[model samples]
Target: MRQWTTGRERAWRLLLIAALAAPAVCFADGDAVTAKAKTSLNIVVGSREARPGKEVSVPVTLQTNGLKPAVLKMTIRFNPAYVSYVEEEDGAAAVGADKVVTAFELPSGSLNVVVAGFNDNAMNDGLLFNVVFYVSNAAPQGTIVPLTCPSGDGVLSAADPLAARLDVTATAGSIEIICKGPPAPNPVAGWFDAQEGAGLTWGESAGAEAYQIYRSEMNDPATAEAVTDWLPSTARQYVDASILANLQDYCRLYYWVRARNAEECASDPGGPVDFVINEIPDAPSGLTATRGHSDGVLLMWNGVPNGAEYRVYRSNNNDPATRQPVSEWMPATFSFMDTTTPAAQYGIAAGCSGRLLLDFFQYTYWVAARHTNGCESDLSEPAQGFRGLPESEAAGVLPERGDLTAWASICVLLMLAHRAWKTRKA
Candidate 1:
């Protein structure tokens, strides 16, 4: 029984040795079959964040170890959900496995490979590949990309370390306009109150290089005029003092602005504003007056066109007294009657009564013309008049009464005597 047991044990050991030696022999017959694969893959993504309509590039590397002149065929796959083929080059050709492969070339150093593609759809999706190529503008913010490599030969059991995850973000391009001061009023009749220069402001944008400004009159809509030259800096405010004119009876004015890049243009027209002008009235002119009768004075003056009325002033001592309205402003008649006692009491002084009656009297009057628009003329030159005393009582002489031949003779004698004396004194 012990001998039989020993034979069975010998058979078991031989079978174990054969099983181990069989693999070694088989490996020696063909190319040495290493326990692990000699192939390695690495992926690198460029510009994880991208703008719309832009291209992205990815680099891929494959290395072979162990034997010289070893042949390596690498297949790279991209998730169709996330990437689109823009262009491909090298021995790398598209195969049925949703992949591209570079055919065997003797492993020359470490193979440095690169591939690039784009994202055409306006959506975000996960990308899985040894390398990923896509633009991010169409993709949503914060997209993660994973790289993977399938195990190849038993000689290369482990894939290259997974590349760092690539995160994608999207950027946008835009433009805007800004206005500085209040807009000019529409239908501008009188004058523009705008400062020297005023217009809209432009905000920052990605592609815009300059801006254009437009203006039009409210009355004449067909006459749309463009301001000269592009606004140089990003600042979009434009000074348009040149566009305004005097007495332009405009109903409303409109403005429009636009942004431009080398290739594209965007426009924004702000709301319109309405305006009108206010003018001051002209001063009144041609004021004059004339005098009239006993215990009453009639005043008259030339009429001013559009004159509302006239103001009259009277003074007995040449000083300007209170002024009274001759008529309502711009009145049809430019005449007035002065019925005051001072104006009516016009008389000569009586001489040789109990005492010489002194009638020292002078009067002065002024007139001003007013326009309907509230403009007043300068005062007219004063009109003057005077009253004198009678001469009968002067020279301390009296008329003598003569009757019949004798009285007549006496009166003639006295008159002759008085005349002779006055003439001698003169």
Candidate 2:
């Protein structure tokens, strides 16, 4: 009976130990109670820097590590006092193990989304997921972004706080100028020319104190050579005629203008204006020519200053009396290829004979320059070239005899014959 009782007690104690050990084993294998599940939640705002009138979008992502899925109830709360909140989509209640996304906008208020939540089993955890929204007429100029997530749980769970500072900035405004010029040919005058001055205009701006005008002759607008004193009020139009000049004949001239406030603060340089200067007319010079290949002759001359056009004349002979001008004057060019002035037609050389060729042939040509203003220069030096047979034409026409002996014998016979005839006659 003692052994039986001892055995029974040992069995009972073993059962108690087994019960305690089983729970420990189950816990160690992670099958006892719901394993401490870990989940990661994140929040993102589209643009931390938003304009006062512009809208902003915010997104939230939740992730978890566990077999059973978690019911992630994400609620974005904003500081109603500062900003307005508009829920773009309903809350994501049961967020799977995978990532889930939710977006919202700040309709009105300064502070945006403030809290987030996750429900798993019967346990609930609140996540601090908040974003602040702000608006301003001007850009927020700074490096750091100010964002905070204020979180709290209904179950009194410790609030997990999160924050992200936004990098907000403002956009700059631009100033430009449009220019108008005078009619062609007449060209704008100096300061007196109304069309010569640059036209100034401003695009968009809240309000400027006093507008200032700046000018620079060099291409660089930053290094302005001159600046106008601060005006009493902002002006849309300002003329800078100081740099205008009639003597400026270059193809292109550069100009730019900018505005400033009463405090002497200046905006960016205005758009650039390019002006074209009209050229003045001048006369031609140095006209001359020489015989070229073929029956043609080549005429050349130096370009005339301020000369807009040229006229060329051809004469049949060097003597003005024998010289009749060609039918019409040819338009002046740097060089004239006189192919039509044939050697025969112009009585240029002795070989030429077609139309009552002259015995003594000497031809001449002349050139004159005309300006755009109808100004003409004196005729160029007459270019004279001669073409005629030499004084001893007989020498060139006779043929030469190779043997004088034969010619001598022939001459003696002719003399003897002449003597015989004379004797007979006697």
Tens-digit lDDT track for model 2 on 237-284? Answer: 556655456325233344444444433334455555544334433434
Error of 2 at 289 (Å): 61
Candidate 2 lDDT at 407 equals 35
- TM-scores of all candidate predictions against the true structure: 0.23, 0.24
lDDT score at residue 307, model 2, on the 0-100 scale: 58
Per-residue accuracy of model 1 over 159-274 as CA lDDT, tens digit each: 32211111112111111111222222222212245444334443444455666566675434345566757665365455567645633343334555555555323333333322
In terms of lDDT, the poorest run of 10 residues in model 1 is: 22-31
Instruction: Please report the candidate that would top TM-score against the real structure.
Output: 2
